[model samples]
Target: MLIELKNVKKYYRTGKLNVKALDGVDLSVEGGEFLAIMGPSGSGKSTLLNIIGCLDKPTEGEYILNGKNVERLNDDELSEIRNNYIGFVFQTFHLLPEYDALFNVEIPLIYRGISARERKERAEAALEAVGLKERMKHKPLELSGGEQQRVAIARALVQEPLLILADEPTGALDSKTGNSIMELFCRLNEEKNLTIILVTHDEKMARYGKRVVHILDGRIESITLN
Candidate 1:
């Protein structure tokens, strides 16, 4: 399994009240699987994503990424795991408007202290993978919604991470542009064997994945394999 979660629980303490965002959830994601998580607001969908991505720790139970238990890792170790093993794509592009596409893609490599020449070369390769090689010098603001999202995808690819976690990746684009983005995801999954976990409210968007998981009231309602 690429990911394994056993009876995971995430609780939030707000003053005198305790809210359970995730209530004893158990899940697993196999390597090279394209999975989509769907849910209504407050369903703990995002919380689950955060936990799986190693961005947040579970309040209880075990979170094992690949063969290692994340609950045993310290903050610095977890950060290292996130940088070296996982890639994230957000709804809002999240690209720095001031930086060119190449520079933006180099940010993750910079954190890892990769040499400047290697970073540029790898970033260019990633952009080429996304068919944005010619747009490497353009800033985020200069690209269209679809192009900007492609740049974000390239940035994620630059790390060559084990998994990609995308939170509503197409929410900011129009229908046509969103379809293009989702299609790109499908192509990447087939061509690169990239393990992808995406969160979206759109059923059409969810269909792009091989399996769809539905969440409700902080619990998994169903899992449908397409």
Candidate 2:
């Protein structure tokens, strides 16, 4: 399995109250699988995604990613794993306003200590893969919503990660643009064997996945294979 969560739990302390974000959630994602998670706000979907992406730790239970127990890894180890193995696409795009498209895509490679030449080359290739080769010099403000999202995808791609974790990837785009982005993801999954775990509140968006997992009140309500 690419991801495995066993009886996982997460809790948040707000003032004197303790809120359980995840309650004994058991989930798994296989290689090359395109999975979608859907739930309303406060349903623990975001918490689950955070744990899977190594951005947050679980309060209880085990999280084994690619057969390694994540709980055993230290913060630095976890950071390394996240940088090398997981690619994240956020709803906000998260691009730096001061940087152009190519520079934004090259951000992750800098942390990897890649040579300047290699960084530019890889960033160029990633932009080409996302069909944004011509926009390399354009800043985020100059791009459309769809184009900005594509730059985000290119940034994620520059890492050549084993898994793509997208949280409401199309939230900022119109329906037409969102559908096109979904098509791009579908193509990537088929052509590159990318494992995608996407989280969204839209049922229509969730339908794009081969499998769907629904959460309610910090627990999984159903798992549907399409």
TM-score per candidate? 0.97, 0.98
Pairs of residues at least 3 apart in sequence or in different chains that clash in candidate 2: none
Please give the CA lDDT of all the candidate structures: 0.93, 0.94
For candidate 2, write residues 115-147 as lDDT tens digits. 999999999999998999999999999999999
Per-candidate total of colliding backbone pairs: 0, 0
Model 2 bad stretches (over 4 Å): none
Model 2 score (lDDT): 0.94
Residues 10-123 of candidate 1: C-alpha lDDT, one tens digit per residue: 999999998899998889999899999998878898999999988899999999999999999999999989999999999999999999999999999998899999999999
